[model samples]
Target: MSLLNSLKWKAELQAITDTVDEYDRPKEVRTKVRDIYFVEIGITAEEKYLSQQAKTNVVRRIKCRWDNTISEKTNGLLIDGVEFNITRIYVLPEVREMELSLAYVD
Candidate 1:
């Protein structure tokens, strides 16, 4: 199947905004940026070992169409009623795609 067709999983990109409540307490509000489709990529054993050694929590990788709004500041992704924190983002300019590394939110 084509890459675009393989992207069957739908996800919501979320960003955390810091705001002050009426009582003056700082609060984090999660807002959805946009919806996207992606295909999950398998994690290689070597990559897993390296991430473990580096103390990174990345457990999953997904590839989607390029989106300029997705940056390091993006908090997490909501997919299938589950939340996953975005650990890293890799941009492929040649293909206009982006790969995101994710870790389960505790």
Candidate 2:
């Protein structure tokens, strides 16, 4: 990757890093925890395998530490420690938390 792209990823990674407390601070401090890949349908071989679980049209998957904000009522945050699979996403007002599945972009 170019320096600019590398720097961009690092910057975004730090933003996500700030959300955690000192006690749970990540062991590694770089872009290792914040890397994302995109899996598209047809365009790439990745979609064929991922869409196997579904009977409908092909979809996409990406490895991302999805942005999540916790609600005071729901405890604060959920889905930490990286590795986010975004099959389908929804916002639950009750808990004010974002629920995610385990699927990453190929």
Candidate 3:
């Protein structure tokens, strides 16, 4: 199947916004920015070994169309009511797509 056809999963992209409470204490707020379609990719043996060596709990990898709004400050993704933190982002400019490395949150 084509890549676009394979992108069947929809997920919410979230970002952290800093806000101050009434008492003037700073707080981190997670807000949904947008919904995106992605295709989940299986973790390979090399990636698993590297993640183990790096002590990173990478549990999922996904690919989606390039989104300019995504940045380093982007918090995490919500998929099927489960949250996953973005461990790394690999942008494929030639294809206008991005691969996201994710780890389970909590």
Candidate 4:
């Protein structure tokens, strides 16, 4: 139960798709679904460094409601038209809050 005003940016949680390339190799593609939303974005000092070391280019943490339509294995977030790969999902103790660790996709 945090204040809602901090959640400023609107985003979309996208589902992952597996498709074959011209070389016949499997590639994971993310497609935006109908489930778009507003979410809170934050960045911690520790998290920033850890992501940098991991070479994931993760610049922020995103907080949003839990959606049955998405999961860490099958979805990512699109915020401000920037694509981010979801590296982890942390569900708060109350199960009402979901925090995602996002890695920028270039």
Candidate 5:
């Protein structure tokens, strides 16, 4: 994965957290529960044409896509269409796990 991809993923994760936080309850989710994928935000190279120098210019923008996928299986709870896997379920202090899912993109 490239740096851009990593940063984009982090942003997307934060977005998910924000969305979940707005829920009425701790809506348990699942990952890849349905025929869905993730969204990757970016400016398509073909969207714009620029000179060599212009192409080298860096721009800050936010974009997203729903095409990323995790073709793996593990012990987790499926909610709606998201996956809340037991990434790290502890017993002492608290349970630590992560919910994953393919972005539901139409």
Candidate 6:
């Protein structure tokens, strides 16, 4: 597809891993599934104002592809040493492509 050709960023798709620590407490970890290169990715920031608190927060939007990988809402994407939390996933018909909505962790 022509959209795939415009992809310029490379990123790793990671899934959540459940584990128990020494105390037997449940813990969630992220493990990399694979590296996807030539991916079309874009990060943008928007200022959100909270009228009640008179505060503003910078929200970042991360757009990328599903890349045929099994991804869920719990999955995270790592790009350029930055980790993003997957907010939502939009899949197209035939499962040929997907759009990920992400928010920056930091």
Best lDDT among the predictions, by candidate number:
3
* RMSD (Å) of each candidate, 1 decimal: 2.2, 15.9, 2.3, 2.6, 16.7, 5.0
**lDDT of each structure?**
0.83, 0.33, 0.84, 0.75, 0.29, 0.61
**Candidate 6 Cα outliers beyond 4 Å, as residue runs:** 38-58, 62-69
* Residue-by-residue lDDT tens digits, candidate 3, 48-69: 7887788887899999998877
Model 1 local distance difference test score: 0.83
Q: Please say which candidate is ahead in lDDT: 1 or 5.
A: 1
Sort by TM-score, best first: what order? 1, 3, 4, 6, 2, 5
The residue-by-residue lDDT of candidate 6 on 1-106, one tens digit each, is 5756766677888897789999999987889888765454443333233311333222344444545555655578887898877665667656355766555664
Q: For candidate 3, report its TM-score.
A: 0.80
lDDT of 1 by residue, 1-106 (tens): 5777888999998997789999999987778878989999978787778777867777899999988878756478888888887777889998888999887776
Which of candidates 2 and 5 reaches a greater TM-score? 2
lDDT of 5 by residue, 3-95 (tens): 334432322121112124475665434333332222233433543233123433222222223223322233333334333322222122222
The alpha-carbon lDDT assigned to residue 8 of candidate 6 equals 67
The whole-model C-alpha lDDT of candidate 3 against the native structure comes to 0.84
Comparison by lDDT, 4 against 5, better one: 4
Any idea what lDDT model 5 has? Answer: 0.29
Worst 10 residues of 5 by lDDT: 10-19
Off by over 4 Å in 5: 1-74, 93-106
Candidate 4 clashes between residue pairs 3 or more apart in a chain or in different chains: none
Provide the global lDDT of candidate 2 against the true structure. Answer: 0.33
Q: Which stretches of candidate 4 lie over 4 Å from their true place?
A: 1-8
Let me know the TM-score candidate 4 reaches against the reference structure.
0.75
